[model samples]
Target: MNPVKNMRREDMGLQWLAIGLFCCFVILAGGLWYVQIVSFKKYEKYREVQSYRTVRIPAPRGLIYDRDAQLLADNEPNLNIVVYLDQLREDFTRTYHDLKGDKDLPYLEGLELEKDARYLTVSNMVYEASVIIGKPSALVRSEFESHYYRHRYMAMPVLTGLSREQMARFMEQGSRLKGFDLEVRSKRRYPNGSLAAHLLGYMRPRQRTSNEEAATLQMSFDYELPDFMGKYGLEGQYEDELSGEPGAKSILVNNMIYRQEEEEWLPLLPGKHLYLTLDTDIQKAAEDALRYLNPNQQRRGAIVVMDCNNGDVLALASAPTFDPNIFTGFLPASVFKPMIDPKGSLPLFNRATYGRYHPGSIFKIMIGLAGLESRIIDPEVEFFGQGYFPMRGRRIDDTAGAGYFNFERAFYKSSNAYFIHYGLKLGPETIVDYGNQIFLGKETGLLPAQETGGYFPSKQTVRKGWHPGDTANLSIGQGKIDVTPLQMAVMTSAVANGGTVFWPRIVAGWESMMPNGASVFEPEPEGRIRGRLRASPQSIEILQKAMLADVENRNGSGSICRIPGYLIGGKTGTAETSFKNSNGRRIKHTWF
Candidate 1:
């Protein structure tokens, strides 16, 4: 009697179970729809943020050229073997599984095992690359591990500065390797080797400044290419103009962190080219002249050639130069040590502008002008010398010997007695005033951070310690007087060009390189006058005539420097200097 009722109840229970299952299916469907459609963009954006990466691309540095459009400094393409970490992820996973199965290997776990796995995979790739390039290459374990941990998004460099043959080999075989690629980078090169090293200066790897680091922290970039910075000379002076603006690139990556495609977000703006006014031919000539003066190269001196009409430095040469290319990368102690050696010739020093020397009889030119201005001596006046002059209870020797000397004869003979006599009469103030007019006590403003304004006694210094002996010493270009070869060049140019002092021009102008390979920029004007000497035309003309006779006359002290039919006028003199030796004994230094 209850069988039919029981069967109906069982059917109802089954119906209830089916209805509950249907309800659960509906709830799951709604949840799937909410996740797949309602918030699809949000999760997609999150995935993109995790997978994609931004990279910073460094712009190429500007080119440097000489006055005649000769390439001095330029960038050369350097080939490098790079390992794309994104493409190595799958290999890293597969290698990790294989490594885990090795029973003979030491127990490794967590990050340590993962690091070994990544390094092993990368090392194998490097070995394969080396074989293809026909060169031996290796990856440091610690370096690879550190890079994997900190800079996995960035490509790891396996081989740098590849030779042309090696680069060609890699280009052929590297495409077969999944994560391997060849990258070309611009490297700074000096085409002239050591020529004009001191004037051109050098470069070093750029480091992120505090401000740059802070700015980078605010932006998003997964990798950054290395940059360079100018260290000295014109390089340092025009750093901003030479270092171009950096650009950015967006790297599209897959879910496994493999790079898919890359697009440059911003194009790099290249730096402007720097054109210097240095004449290579004249520079070589000036250097050659100095070398000829000291055949053994033991003598230290500087020679400067300038355009008399404009004060443009044609050449500024100093002995004992160095190659600037060594500073482009890591500077070894072997290369850098010699430059800093106290006992060495100091090849890094720009002696033409930085070296201060006693002008010797050369100062007589200024003394002659001073005497003329003070009316103490006329160009035609004659005086007698007794081979020496007695002063301060001591007799000052003269190289010109005892004779009756006019201004022309005394200057041509470099008569120290003749000039010293007039110097005492003209006094220190008037002489210093004339020296100031020649810009003797001030910088020439030619090369910044590469010039020294040679020491000249100020009126205050003279007034504080006024003495007849001091006046005599100052008159002969000794005592407190000092001059650079560059200053002497300027002085000589002023004498040649009727008293107009021009600010020495070095860098002619800048030219900007455009994408179409065309250059654009304004040229800096030539012959910018700095100041004019206060000497009257008549005084300048008299000084010029004396200078001409000093070289043109057969018995002139500077006759040795005379050129045929050039009418070149010059003065020569010797200065006495003393320095303490290593044993603490004073030693005399004779300078010409």
Candidate 2:
């Protein structure tokens, strides 16, 4: 009983000590809560510093169309691959540590080495991508370096324009392998190849302009990627209206890559369609005729067929054209650029409204009109024709050889002497007045960029050192008087339509998008008023008869222009371009 009591006293003391230990554990837990609850944000920030991601969102481009609602330029599905730089940092550090290979390396001791290690991280990623995609690749070192140095948040593009097979392989193998992604992008397509190349135009590599783009990040486009903009023609002029606004997306990104978590922004807008006055069938026809005449080589020629009723240019053809599609990609030396050089021929030159040539015998029509109005010459007045007329000591030759001629005979024959005699009688001042009275020597203002202001020698221009020779030259459609085929067509149209001159138009109407699909807007006619010719019906009748005879009469110079069942009025010309060439030799350039 005494031994038991002594043991119990010590055991009782040990039991009390165990109870105090339990209470101390509770106190330690409460202290832990006090510190952790207050400092949780700091620890969360530390974790975020270890792993966070950023991604980029690409905006969708606008659609392009032809006048008839044909899709000329549209986006095709393109698969793009990009890599996130931030996610690889941890792996890079681990790789760096392994590469050091048991060397005694203090943390943060090698600053330049760390930079190299960072580069190696990206390089390894590229190597892995190359191996997975079966493509030879490495970091475009300078580009990578620059991008990382400038914008660390931006996702780097490893590859673009991936094929369907490649994209499938990427998704199946590359995406699962990590740090690589698949994205659908839009690529521009031209469905008709080279049709309407000059008119539809082509695009160049351009960044998204701030005014055209919706978001701010979109404007920070750091690369000069291939994109197209209309360079010339109607395409260049109406680019803005045709190129609709670009839409944006706010991409939700985790620190890993361009994950495309959510497209939290605006939708894309499609472009409007354009309608032109050009009839594809007629344009093709006109082009065929020019080619048929000179099939061996490209001849410097133009054709303009207009609807005399309204100023609609049914067809305007020019030789030496290019397919607009080629301009969108890499332009070869064989195309539109060569002609622009000073030494090059510029065969693709639009000559319908642009080429200014001496009117030649065609001007005799205007001269005949003026003479009939002046009453200096009558249709019945027979003048004894000589092969050449002596004028101011210079002899002017007639296209027709010597014969007795009335106005109608002279007109049908295109006698230079007869017209010269009448043209001089009208005086250079009246002729100049008539030239100016019509829109000659000025722009027709149809397409200013594609047109020229034809020249007419004014009295002021003539009197400055005026010579009777100059007047004589003017009499036969030579000297400082030049006109475009378009101008001639206008004159002919005026004669056909009772003397109302017109401004030529190419666009008939435009198509717009309705809620369902597409809708077309109508076209309005364009033209101007030139002075009305107060012609005697007899005079007009005589001139019309001569013009018809010029085409219908087998002996007439313009016999080739005669079309069966169609009473055609016509004139033909062959003119010389120069008096001399190199090597001190006399030469001449001719057009038939």
Candidate 3:
């Protein structure tokens, strides 16, 4: 064997080994690059999914004010004692280990153990917190368990609506309690109590929104802080504007599912303030007038005052009122029972907008206009009355005695016979046409879902199935004709402000919250005009004189409603309704 050949063979074998080692090194480097750069974002996202949670925070609601800038509905600070679950992780683990001891317990399994540990830890903390705060506090086991299962990411509320004394105690001693703190939240409050309760409406607990942004975040939300909703009146009408845009926060958690820190990614946008046309003083006066009118308050009625020039509602008062603040907290059965009573007075009912009543002689205003427009009767023309008007051989009795009376005399006396005579002479279609012109038998479109379009006979019904008896009943705001006090106010306002009928205005505009809170939005000028009366100027003048006579004349029936310094003019009315009594006997429902 040659030595040189053997050395060459060994060198070649070493070369082959080096080549194999180089290939292996190249493969390792390529794999490292792919993992460190190409797939970095995927793994990072996986880590984030395990440790990050998104929470929704409700934005503060806007304030509500009257025309004079008086606060009607507002948000007051509410102190609550809350438990942060993430901070309690160590305590929960410690409790679980203590309960387990040195042996494996059968009950200490996944869900059961977690629930038991959480409840025990939170309950003990709540007890300790109670002593520190000097208030008796309790956390139900079921409540704690349910909260842990459903809303583990959010802070659990243990004690809510703390008073000043309790809050002071908590602030003084809260530092000693782990995972416990006082959170200041806003709560709806009506400072004036029951005043304008129906107009201001009430608020309910926060609920999840159904807006577009909320829909996108529905699946991503780990915990959602609720926002309040308006249940009625102006609050309900403008819910979206009053409840501002919600903000979002992200919580960075540890491997143990405990929160390390939280950052607000989206800041809340505060809601715009609302300004209403209601005058506080006038509203109080109207409510007081209604209350004192009848000592027993058995007389259920409503009063509505309006700005004849602009159609802005000044005051709307309804009897059997309730304090809207009752809805803010847990309502007692004593307070709640009467409001829901079906057989008794419904205090929740807004009589000014919802109640339907026979306008009685007030309908005579429309009848007088119809007669003057259609040339059926003159204001000075005298009609002979025999204490009652004859209709289809039946007599409709009048409060005014039999006499040869003109329009002014009959109007001041509220003569049913005189009005009924003109009502029949004008025919049902002519009268129904005039009623429809003023938006009778139609919704006023003021307060949504809070108003009703009272019953008014259609022209078709009067023309197709016409009857003298029906005509007679319809003549004096009876039979099928019914109206709300708000509607009557509009009618009165139309008479006062020439022939233009304006849509009733409740909310004046949207205002800012800053000092001097100027209006951001106002109702359009044309939005206030509902319709205009087709009556001639002379006709309106005649009706105005007759109405004034009803208040100023010596024989006036509406003299009781007269204010000494004010030369106010109004007409009085009485309506009769039949109903069966508890003894099954017929009884009359009289309204004056």
Candidate 4:
């Protein structure tokens, strides 16, 4: 009897368990159905009502200044006329309804008509604002449509870089206009105009943010504030460092796409200041000597001056230059066209770092270094020059001809046969060894993306097509080689600074621009040795004495550079590019 009672109790327990499972399944299904079908539209409406539109606002680019706190490239306040599209939604709706009254149109056609209405409203608003400022403005239909369809949630740029008079008039009378407001954005300005244009570089308008930043925000931007991207020189090279992190703002909109509120989602981090090693006085003076003092004021040439102690670029001047300030605004065809013309002298081209031409006799510095370091050169020993270096039955003409020359006489005179004679004794391997040692076939690590290493014979190339003629040309800085002015400066510097070859440094340091008129500088290391020439102090003194004579002596090749105040030490170079001026005049590349 007890066994039968236990069985009945077990059966009741199983039945209760089955009933509980059935109830749980029913509740789960009911909840699923309620959420998927019943409350779907309600929650969807709420999601749409709380929509967020992200717009990226780029931080101001870092200010660029010389080592002495003289501003080379900086930002000035630019008054831009902009209109908040969200604030104009009411105007758009009213205009659309008025335009579509009593008209039955297809869905697509109606969308097109609504677009037209929006454009008309914006155009009218811009026109009214322009009337107050007494300035005429044009609102192209296509441009207006593109902005509306692509970025309706963002502020539309109407007019940029306005004059003070126009800005004052707008504030006085046109502030009452709906949706139109003046925004003050940082506009790049060079106080000295074209001064240091090549080094400081230029900026072009490009509204964008990096993919990494966009991913970090976990949002797609609907619009971005207009920002400038550096095109060349210091501005372009350190773009990432100079371009501070962009800020973000979210536009909260209602279900009807009306902007309800706005909030700054991220604080704007201002860009750092790039302190350069340029001396304004020397830079200006160099420019004046190159351009204003020259017989032909519009000469296409480049000049480079470096501090031998640290490879600091003191002055880098390129003639036939344009103003950097011209790039940030409406660049007329008249100004920008000539700079980019293939047949014309391209002022935008940085001749100092990028242009490649035969190094000429300036390369003799390396030849001399090679000879002295290899113990084959005696500064006191003399050699006879036959006016030219003969190789492969071919004669390479020399400026210093038919003279008995020693290391000092030949160097100051730039005697090709004498240097070539010694350079041959050292062999191509020894010379190439020394050339590559000074990073001759490589960039000086000066500008970011702006330097060519110039052409030097690599170990592989020198090993293979090994010709005595090539070595002869290498001695005189003429054949199968080219260099820029910056490279020459580094070469000259090495000789002056006792063969401690350095990586040229243009940007000295960088520090973030603080808000409270303070800065924290992170100084970059000075005199970073890229390679060593392995030359002794006596060899260096010999070269210095020769270079000094080249300037100080009357018959020396570089005698023109000799002035009373400065004891200049230099080598003379004449590169035969066979390049003629646009006017068909013979303009020489007399490298000094």
Candidates, ranked, TM-score: 3, 1, 4, 2
Number of clashes found in candidate 4:
1
Compose the digit string of candidate 3's lDDT tens values, residues 27-137.
999999998899999877666555778887877888888889899999998889998997887888898787777876565374577677778888988998888777787
TM-score for model 4? 0.85
Summing lDDT over every window of 10 consecutive residues in candidate 3, give the lowest-scoring window: 518-527
Per-model TM-score versus the true fold: 0.88, 0.75, 0.88, 0.85
What would the per-residue lDDT of candidate 1 be over residues 214-262, giving only the tens digit for each residue? 3864565667787778887788888878977778888776555556678
Q: How well does model 1 score by local distance difference test?
A: 0.83
What lDDT does candidate 4 reach at residue 323?
89
Task: Pick the lDDT winner.
Answer: 4
Q: lDDT tens string, model 2, 273-352?
A: 56665666666777777779778875657788887767777667676655655555556776656767656546556777
TM-score of model 2 (CA atoms): 0.75
List the pairs of residues colliding in candidate 3.
Answer: 206-227
Better of 1 and 2 by TM-score: 1
How far is 258's C-alpha from truth in model 2 (Å)?
Answer: 8.0
List the candidate 2 regions with Cα displacement exceeding 4 Å. Answer: 1-140, 143-196, 207-226, 249-268, 332-337, 462-464, 514-522, 526-541, 579-592
Q: Which stretches of candidate 1 lie over 4 Å from their true place?
A: 1-25, 29-48, 51-55, 102-110, 212-223, 250-263, 293-299, 514-518, 580-592
Where is the poorest 10-residue window by lDDT in model 1? 102-111
Cα error, residue 537 of model 2, in Å, equals 5.4
